[model samples]
Target: TVDKYGDNSIKLGITNMLIGEYLHTIDNKKRLAVPAKLRDKIGKKAVITRGLDNCLFLYPLKEWEALAEKLSKLPVGQGDTRSFIRLMLAGASEVEMDSLGRILIPDYLKNYAELKKDIVIAGLYNRLEIWDKEKWSLYKENAGRNSEEIAEKLGELGVY
Candidate 1:
């Protein structure tokens, strides 16, 4: 089967699944070093944008393109949809890794996510989510406490 992009669906099945959580530091210049393992999957260029829960989402160029295509097709009449699309698209920035595999986070993005010196880079399948270390810690604690309830809800959705 071919997708709307004319690419074989089977080929799309072979996607890079980013996993694991890594701790790193954002230098004074606002650059964060992409983990060598994660860099291998994300390539040299990517799109970074504001994400839900006060984090930044980093998508490899190809993944970002696919997402953008779908988002573009959403009905503009719906206020929620329009706001969501604007939030993701308007906040997006193209970033290229430097020789040392570091990508600079714009000050605006850093401020939005409250990213300080300590940061957490969490790999979530097709994308990476960058979180402020303190915020991530608090979020993780809350999520862990609710894991059982969350799992039950997902089970209702046939996830389990």
Candidate 2:
């Protein structure tokens, strides 16, 4: 299923190509400006939620809706599915961009990601991931060092 936005960007189900990475800072009020290049693609409103690896995920409304649909279809009898759904949905917050294109990160979400002043907003195809700058640096370093191994693992899944 493809959904077209006013700007003509097409979202094909869970596939939205969000590219580029940006460095930003959280203000005293916990607001961070969305990168200008990404502002339109992410839309005026989005859903923020806890993400893997101690980061936060920002999903455009349409993408979030698709993801929520998938999550809703997870087997209800499975404990792991229930837990994962709770973790993702319970922490979700609907946020709208301010006039300056900034979105306020809730305190709980901030604490969950351990976000301080320095932050990194990274484009991850379908979602934008917000991470503490220092943590992002560390993660990049570690991932870089293990890229070969990671690629090998992914190759098994036909991703290589």
Candidate 3:
């Protein structure tokens, strides 16, 4: 968008992508306080669901709806596609952030991600990935080791 000064700037209507990693703790009640920075992008009402790589994915309401719509369009005749649809759509839960910017995670999701007291919330563009602290560390380390190879693959796909 261009402001009165004729310079480009981001406005509310533009997509607000998420990007960052934060360390946090889950309370005994399984309440996770999302980092205020990330929380601002996701808003209050969000959707939590099983994610790839043994983590939980949290999406903003609008992003979730868009994803759900896309998921609904996939061909159900393929076994893998059907399984993926079930894994994502069926396992999704609508969650609301409380007054303290905390979202109470369901036991099923908590167990799926194996979330313990210490947790890592990684903001990846449109979604937030909730992972166990140890797992994140390991994943980050492994990914860091293979970043060059990963970048090559992305380059081949024209992602860079």
Query: Considering every candidate listed, which one attains the maximal lDDT?
Result: 2
Taking the tens digit of each residue's C-alpha lDDT, what string does model 2 give over 92-160? Answer: 999998889999999999999999999999998878999999999999999999999999999999999
- For candidate 2, the 10 contiguous residues with the lowest summed lDDT are 1-10
Alpha-carbon local distance difference test for all models: 0.89, 0.89, 0.88
Off by over 4 Å in 1: 1-15
Which candidate, 1 or 3, has the higher TM-score? Answer: 1
Question: Tens-digit lDDT track for model 1 on 106-141?
Answer: 988999999989999999988999999999999999
Model 3: per-residue Cα lDDT at residue 75:
92
Off by over 4 Å in 2: 1-16
Preferred candidate (lDDT higher): 1 or 2: 2
Ranking by lDDT: 2, 1, 3
| Stretch of 10 with least lDDT, candidate 3 | 2-11
* Cα deviation of 68, candidate 2, in Å: 0.4
